[model samples]
Target: MSVAIVGVAECDLGQTGKSVLELQTQAVTRALADAGIPLSEVDGLATNGISRFSATQLADYLGIRPAWSDSTFAGGAVFEMYVARAAQAIEAGQCGTVVISYASNQRTARSRKMTGVFEEGTPEADFEEPYRPLYPISYYAMVAQRYLHTYGLGRADLAEVAVAARAKAQLNPAAWTYGKGPLTVDEVLEAPMISSPLGKLDCCLVTDGGGAIVLTSQSRGVEVLGYGESLTHTGMATAPDLLRTGAVDSGRRAFARAGLTPDEIDVVQLYDSFTISVPLGMEALGFAGAGEGLYADKPHNTGGGGLACCHPGQLGVLLLVEAVRQLRGSGGERQVPNARTALVHGTGGIFSSHATVILGVS
Candidate 1:
């Protein structure tokens, strides 16, 4: 693919009280401005989690009639999927410049329900909803449970992931947990248990935020090395393996397409909807051997992660944005020195969907 991510930005986070479209507009405008390009140049669009016609609504609200658009929904990983599709479109001459954006007021709107939203009479609703389990946390807790039991580890080990995330967040003023204080493993374990072995701190914060990215055929930005996406199931009940996610396939395809290996990558940004997600993603992406993700010595989530950073309804776009910042050497306090190639992976839909993207400079 010849496309590159030219611009990226996050809208006001933490209780902005703004509508989804308002935050999306802010993200789009700021991202395009950062790219030094006018919004008029965006002939392609991609957006989701707003409405059925997400791309159309976003284009109308942004006042751009795009020649090509995509609104594929696969949970939080959707943005990375959009980048993969947009790259294909550009390579095929279907569109020139594309703006991919997303936003949600789940915080202010108080719409974060404990139950999952499945269609009436679907298998998920019929089988799982009867249990009234917490939509995602319960499912993740089960993963954590199986992983910890298999490894002979305890909750304290999981707490390390949260603590490390908070340590990084302390360096990022944009983080909601920044300047508050540092997190300790004990603190993580002591927090109210949302599920067995999963405490409150194990989960991502409830915040209002959004992010956007501008991709173009222009070569003045980080090069689009390669990308891949995969989905295994819609509900955990149907998941083949709780410990393995779709990233195994996506990451393999991404690395093969990019002609790179994990050893050559300088930075990584894996989804952390829960502390357990880190290990799952790491193992699947070959960053760690089996049962070694939590202990793997690697540079990752330099701007804090969803754990300590802002987590709107979805976090995939912010993962891409932060990876771009790290590669561009603008991470400030959290910057990794001389970073060049970066691998970014986002997990969506209860670990059912995954996408891997490899980026490079020069």
Candidate 2:
């Protein structure tokens, strides 16, 4: 059976004052409108694991309770997994219309709090967070360091990905990182250092926003040609391999399911919480050699990714939105002509979990 994304919507990114539920509601309404559907018709609802909002609250606000509701949290990649699950739900006749939503107030509400750490049972009380590691920035920085050490790559190579993403963001009106013409390698290199090898420009901004997409299996939406998932950590990062992730395994599976290779992908939406991730994803997705994925010619993260967009927990949703828009030839200034196939990579948990989805125009 084939699945398609019929509608996509997102609230004003980077805008504050909107509650998580309100943002989610707006995105839902927009997505339904985009899908040419109605709230009463929505029977399925899937949300990210890390989202603070509740599905019941969303349903109450929308005045339509879904028969199938999933509130699983697997970090940012959960949205990609949600899409894949929506396909099965559509095929099983469990629901003809599914809405996947996520929202967060990272910038204003987060307030430098250690929220992610507290969410997990804090060993802080007993062990003083002995097993606890650094925030995403520091953790991913370690990976970047290891990557640089293992591959002999310098900061300049990583800066290229940031420059490309920022350029793409300039075309994306919804992107928070949107700005003037492309950034130079020197500019990125000179940016303030946030976490050692990872500079300020290399880090994604903190953002608060919500985004949603509607899916149907009737081939009336963007085709869901393939989906694959993999995991590198079990809740915490006790593993030794920090630089490399499960993206390779999942990406290969996704491509095989679509019966296509990396070369066939017209655009790539690589999860770029850190500049290092772009190059890492390139290798995992088979775009270039291991530790050598950062190059000027590749069409990776053309829309600035999380680094540019900074949609808090809604990063994965934005990636899906961009991919769908590109595949439908509706990306306007950022549009890639003849973009028939697209790959969106969603990652979460310090790159511990990953999901890859291949979309095609049918």
Candidate 3:
């Protein structure tokens, strides 16, 4: 069965006070309304359970007791994974409409605690909890270091990605860093290093926000086209080459499932938690050849991305939302004209997990 995203919605990001539950409900309601569907019609609901409230409780609050409700946390990619799962459920006739949501208050309610101390070695130690090795910035910095050494990539090249994304962000109002246009490569390079070779601009902004999307079978809406997922490693340390990520495996599988090639994709939504993530995703998605992986002139994350656009806990959901909007000819300035096919990529599980979704207008 084919599945198409019928509606998408997101609550105001970059603020606190609204509980995760409230934000989730707001997005869900807006999505349903956008699709012209009623809450009583929802038969399935999926969301992450890491920071937010329980799905069971949220379901009750929304007055939706879905026959299929899941609270899965594969990290950032949880929302896209939910979309893939919802497609299968719909194809199996288990659910008619599935609502996937992600909401977080990273700024106010849940601030990241950074002690800058980590205890390495085995997990049996008493300080295992406090000493969690390197944080995400450090992890990506290591990857950035490897890329610089291996590919002769410079800090300026990495800054290009940020500059490009911020440029796009200026064109989008929903983007958190909008109006903050054209961040120069020099400035990015000069920015304080979050980790060796990784500057503050290289890191994603932590903001409070939530987003959600509504998916239904093709007969009821649009066709899902193809979806694929692959994990490079269980842990970040086990990754063989952080510069070139597992997005390739995931992208290839998604393309094969869709019976399409990278050339067929008109727009791409690569998970851009950091600038390096863009090249990593581009390489994996076959947008650029191996070792020659670079972003294309084709429309990519025209809505800014997690960099400029607010990347709440459920940021990947926003990617799917934008992809669907563009494919449906609804994206205004950011729309890729005549774009019939779109690729939405998500990463999670300590960068070990990667998921890709190919959507086409049927």
Most lDDT-accurate candidate: 1
- The 0-to-1 C-alpha lDDT of every candidate, in the order given, reads 0.90, 0.80, 0.78
How would you order the candidates by TM-score, starting with the best?
1, 3, 2
For all predicted structures, in order, the TM-scores are 0.97, 0.92, 0.92
Backbone clash tally (model 2): 3
lDDT of candidate 3 over 1-362, digit per residue (tens) = 67878888887788767776787788889998999999999999888643344678778888777988778767677677787899889889999889988777767676754221223443423442354545666677777777767887788888888888888888788888877657998989899987778888887778877777888874655568888888776545567767656677878888988999989989999888888788778877888765455546657987889887887754788898888888888787777899899999998744677889998886
> What's the count of clashing pairs in each model shown?
0, 3, 7
What's the residue-level lDDT of 142 in candidate 3? Answer: 71
lDDT of 1 at 172: 95
215-250 per-residue lDDT for model 2 (tens digits): 877666689999999988743346447756889888
Residue pairs with backbone overlap in model 2: 5-222, 49-72, 49-73
